[model samples]
Each structure stands twice: as structure tokens, then as C-alpha cells.
Target: MELTILGTAAAEGWPALFCACDTCKRARAVGGKNLRSRAGVQFGKTHRVDLSPDTWYQEAHLGADMSALEYLFVSHSHDDHWQPHCLAYLRPPFAHANNTPVQVYGNEAVVRTGRAELGAEQTIAVFNEVAPLKPIPAGEMTVTPIVASHKVGEQCLNYLFASEGKNVLCAWDTGLYEDESSWKFVENVRLDCVILECTCGPSKCERYHMDYEHYLAFKERLEKAGSVSSECIFVATHFSHNVGILHDELEQYFSPHGVCVAYDGMKIVL
Candidate 1:
């Protein structure tokens, strides 16, 4: 399994365009690994998560093609997470002729919103409404949507993706797992990596996103439940400018405990 971090920031991103906050200013100073954008990821050029408003930015900067992506999992319709309107890029003949159609999987609401936004375009991407725990195959991987503990004004999800013997728990844009039933799926499945959310400034309180406190708690719970391996790696991402902490700050907090803080364009081969 291969994981790529195209973007790893909260809705506003780590260094907000017009933000003049201390954290944002600090991030600007260290403009490398600390910089982030709306979150998203891809696997081996085929499967993907959400299509953020920054989708084109990711493609341009990361050298990825939207038409080449085969499976897209919409984690819900939050503005930062869902940019169905962006699918216009997937129109007929797409950026190139060799590209295949992108297949999107999500809930009824997500499908409805995607269709409404993209119109009835028949060649961009295909949509499939899926429920939690229902596994679907994508290339050489199998993806299972897990009910997420996020604002459900629209449906949201975190995914459990497994390829070969490697499994990754895709988590972000939400605080602690609020649903116990979903915790069961997390507990029962062992994972090789955990892509978690740590969107916080050094002083920000935890809400709608996880902070260091929740991050630690998640580690403790996973250890107790034996849902991870000794070699299991933890990845923290989804940064917000308000959560002024940067990569080194996060490494200071996470590395000693064997966790990794992700950066835009970073890739991990599992």
C-alpha cells in the first residue's frame, strides 16, 4: 500500500491566505513542511478520498491527474472536503484520452449533491452510494467506509482501507470518535498506519477537530484494544492556521511516541 499526502490542513489550511495570527505568521516563516491545504489523499494512482476545493492545486503541484483516479470516497459534503463542482475537470476526454472515469462512493446525500453540482455529465466520474462497513474493491485495494463522528448536517465518514496485509485508518476533520458502534470496527481491525487529525494551535481548545489530548487518548485506546502493531506508524495531519503548531512542534509532541506528522506531498510506502 502506498499513501500520499496531497494536503493536510483544516478547512482554513495551516497558513491562512489572509490570516495574520501569530501561528500563521510563524508558519509563514517556516514555509516548508508546516504549510498545508484542505485535506485529501490518493493510493497508487487509483483510489482517492475526498476531492477538496484544492483538488486542482494538488494535481498541479503533486503531478496527479484526476481522470487517472479510479475510486473516490467522499467523506461527506463539507465545503473543504467536498468540491463536487470541481468535477468539471473530469469532463469528456478529461485532461487526456488515456484516463479512465473516476468512480465516486458515498452516501445518498453526497450522491445527490454531487449530481446536482456536476449536472448529468456522463463521462467525468461515476457515483455509487455506499453504507458503512460495506467493502468495495478498488484496483488492488479494498476500501470500507466507517461512520465518522463529524457534523452530520451532511453525511460524513472516515475510511478503513486495506491492501495486501496493510490497513490504514483514515481519520481527520473530526474530534474524538463519538459513535461506539463505529469504534467496534476500529477495534476489531488491526492497522499498519493511522492517519489522524491533530488540527490545533499550541493553545487552541479541542472542538470539531482533535488536539494533542485526543491524539494521546486515541493511541492509548488503540494500544489497549490491540488494534495496531508494534511497527504501526501514526500520522497526524489536517492542520488549521489557528492551531499554530507546525511540523517540528508536532514532531516534538509526537515523534518520541513513534507518531509522524504529515506534510503536503509526503509519501509513505507501506
Candidate 2:
């Protein structure tokens, strides 16, 4: 399986749209890895996780062939992650030769929001509502949505993707794993790669997102539980300007911990 980090910023993006903070300023000046748009990942060439607002930019600049996308797994209805309106571009008049609908998998809120925004038009995309812990066959991969500890009133999700004998855990946008059900799901799987959200960066941990300290503890727990081995690739992504660390600094801080700070366009094959 191949994983591509399309975008790696948190909700507001690195060097946020309206931010002038020291970290944002530094990121803008430094460019390169620090210059992120939003969080989104593409598995192989067709299956993707989260349709960020930066999807257009990713396709235009990062060479993402979204037109070839077949499966879209939305984490939640967060603005930074779920931007269903972008699918409108795939609809008639705007798009041509896109006959096959992209099968979208998500929870109730995500499905509702997608139908409300993208309408019943099956020309571009279709929604297939999913619940936590249920494994569904998507293309050549088996995807299991796990409940995420982020936001109230809606079920946010992390995903376990198994394809071609390799398993990847997309643990983005979640806080500490306090749910026993979520932990039970993790314990049974051997992860080849784990992508964690370090939205809070070096800051104090929050209820809905993880910081560096929180990530370390979580990784330690996973390792101890035998869910992740030393050979597993640990990646940190979904950064925020509020994290107060630039790309280089993030790499410096996490490298010793065996975590790769994901940058846009980073690719991994396992």
C-alpha cells in the first residue's frame, strides 16, 4: 500500500489565512514543509481520507489526480476536513468524462452534510454512511472506521485501512484514546504505519487534539500493547499554527521519538 500526505495543516492551515502570529509568520517566511494548506491523505491513487478545502490546490500544484479518485473516507464534518462543495466541481458542466461516482464513507453527520451540500447528484459522488468498528470493503482495501475523541454532537472517526496484507492506521484529529472499544479495536490489529494528529504540537494537551507529549504517551501505549512494532512507521501530521513550531523544529523534536513529521507531498510505501 502507498500513502501520500496531500496536505498537513490543521483547521486554519500553517501561516493561517488571517493569522499573523510568530509561528505563522515564520512558516510563511520559511516556506517549504512549513507551508501547509490543510489535512488530507491519498491512499494509493484512488482512495483518499478527508476532502479538505485545499483539495483544489493539491490537485493543481501537488499533482493530485482527484479525478481518478474512487473512494473518499471522511473523518468528520469539520470544515477543515470535509468540504463537500468541492465535489460540485466534479458535477456536470464543470466536469466531463467523470461517469463513475466516488463512493464516500462517513458517519451520519458527514452523510447528511454531504447530501445537503452536494445534493442527490450521483454524477460525481455518492455517500455510504458508516458506523464505528464496522469493516467495509472499499475497492481493494478493507476499511474500518474507529471512533475518534474529537468534537461533540457528532461521531468523528479514525480509520484502519488494510490492503495487500499491509495495515495503516490513520489516527488523525483525535485526542487521547480513552475509549475501551477503540483500544480493543487497536489491540487486535498489527499496524504497519500510524499517522497521528499533532495539532497542539508542543502545547499542552487539549480534549480534542493531541500535543507532542500526548502523542508520545499514545505511541508508547500502542507499542506496549503490541499494536505497533519498532518497524512501524510513525508519522505526525495535521499541524496548526497555534502549535508554535515550524516544520524543521517539528522534525527536530519528533525524530528522536521515531516519528516522522509529515510534510505535503510526503509519500510512504509499505
Candidate 3:
């Protein structure tokens, strides 16, 4: 499976659209990887996790082709992650020679929110409500949704993608593993690639997101539980300007721990 890190910033994006903070200024000056978009990832042009508003920009600037996307797995209804407006382009004059209806998988809110956006007249896409621990077959992999502690009154999810002999954990927008069921499910599966978020950067956040410390703790806990493969690749992404850590700083902080810092357009083949 080929996984592409499409966007790596938190909801507000690094160097947020409307902020003149020192960190944002530094990000602007650094340019390159320091400048990030909202979070999302694509697997082999067919399976994608999250549908950020930056999808179009990623496609144009990063050379990502989503015209062949078949399955879209949404984490929650957050606009940064689930921008259903893009679905409009999937059909009509915007797209040509593509008749495959994109299958969307998410929780109840995801379904409702998407439906509300597309309305009753829309086609070219189908929404399937996904539940935690319920594995569903994709083209060549099985997607298992895991509960994530991000939003209250919403069934937020992290995903475990198992294909061939490799397992990938897409845990962006996730906090510490608090639910027993979530932990039990993760404990049994061996992860080869972990795409976890370090949204809070240097700050300490254990609720809706993770910080640099939380990233280490999460990795340590996974190691202690013996759930990671010997050659597992751990990546830290989903940055925020609030914490003042740019891409280089992130690399400096996480590199020693064998955790890679993801940048926009980064691709990993497993």
C-alpha cells in the first residue's frame, strides 16, 4: 500500500489564515514544510482518510490524483476533516470519464452531515455508517474503525488498515487511548505504520489531541503492549502554530525517538 501524507496541519492550519502570531510569522518565513494545510491522507489513490478543504489545493500542488478515489473514510464531522462540498465536483461537468460512485464510511454524524450537504438530488457517492471494531472490506484491505477521544457527543474514529501482511494505524485527530475497547482492539493487532497526530506540538494535551510528550507516551504504551512490529514506522503529523514548533523543530524533537515528522506531499510505500 502506498500512503501519501496529503496535509499535516491541525484544523486551523499552521500560519492560520487569520493570525499574526510569532509562530505563524516564523512558519511563513521558513516556508517549505513549515507551511501546512488541514490534515488528510490518501492510500493508493483509492482509499482516503478525511476530506479536508485543502484537498483541491493538495491535488493541484502536490500532484495527488483523487479522481480515482473509491472509498473515503471520515473521522468525524469537523469541517477541516469532512468538507462534503468537494463531493459536488465528483459528478457533472467538473469530472469526466469517471462513473465510479465514491463510497463514504463514517459514523452517524458523518452520514447526516454529508447528506445534509449533498442533499437528496445528489448521486455519485454513497454513505455507509461505520461502527467501532466493525471491520469492513475495501478494495484490497480491511478497514476497522476504532473509537477516538476527540469530540463529545460524536462518535469520532481512528482507523486501522490491514492489507496483505501490513497494518497501518491512521490515528490523526486522536487523543490518548482511553476507552478499554479501543485499547483491547489495538493490543491484538500489530501495527507496521502509525500515522498519529501531534496537534498540540510542545503543549500538553491529553483530551482531544496529542502533544509531543503524548506522542512519546502513546508510542511507549504501544511498545509496552507489544502491538508494534519490529520495523514499524511511526510518523508524527497534524501540527498547529499555537505551540510554535515548525517542521525543523518537530524533526529535531521527534527524530531521536525514531518517529518521522511528516510534511505535506510526503509519501510512504509499505
Candidate No. with top lDDT: 3
Whole-model lDDT for model 2 versus the true structure?
0.88
TM-score, model 2 to reference = 0.97
- Residue-by-residue lDDT tens digits, candidate 1, 61-137: 88655556778998888888888877766654445634546788987888888888777684676778997888888
Q: What are the Cα lDDT values of the candidates?
A: 0.81, 0.88, 0.89
The reply for model 3, stretches above 4 Å from the true place, is 97-99
The 10 consecutive residues of candidate 2 with the worst lDDT sum are 91-100
Candidate 3 C-alpha error for residue 51, in Å: 0.7
Model 3, 94-181: lDDT tens digits are 8873746889999999898888888863577898999799999998989999999889899899999999889999997788977899
Per-model TM values vs. the true structure: 0.93, 0.97, 0.97
Clashing pairs in 3: none
Better of 1 and 2 by TM-score: 2
Summarize candidate 2's per-residue lDDT along 41-153 as a digit string, tens digits: 89867899999989989988887777778899999999999998887777657877454688899999888888888766755778999978999998799999999999888
Candidate ranking (lDDT, best to worst):
3, 2, 1
Q: Between candidates 1 and 3, name the one with more favorable lDDT.
A: 3
Q: For candidate 1, give the lDDT.
A: 0.81
Give the range of the ten consecutive residues with the poorest summed lDDT in model 3: 91-100
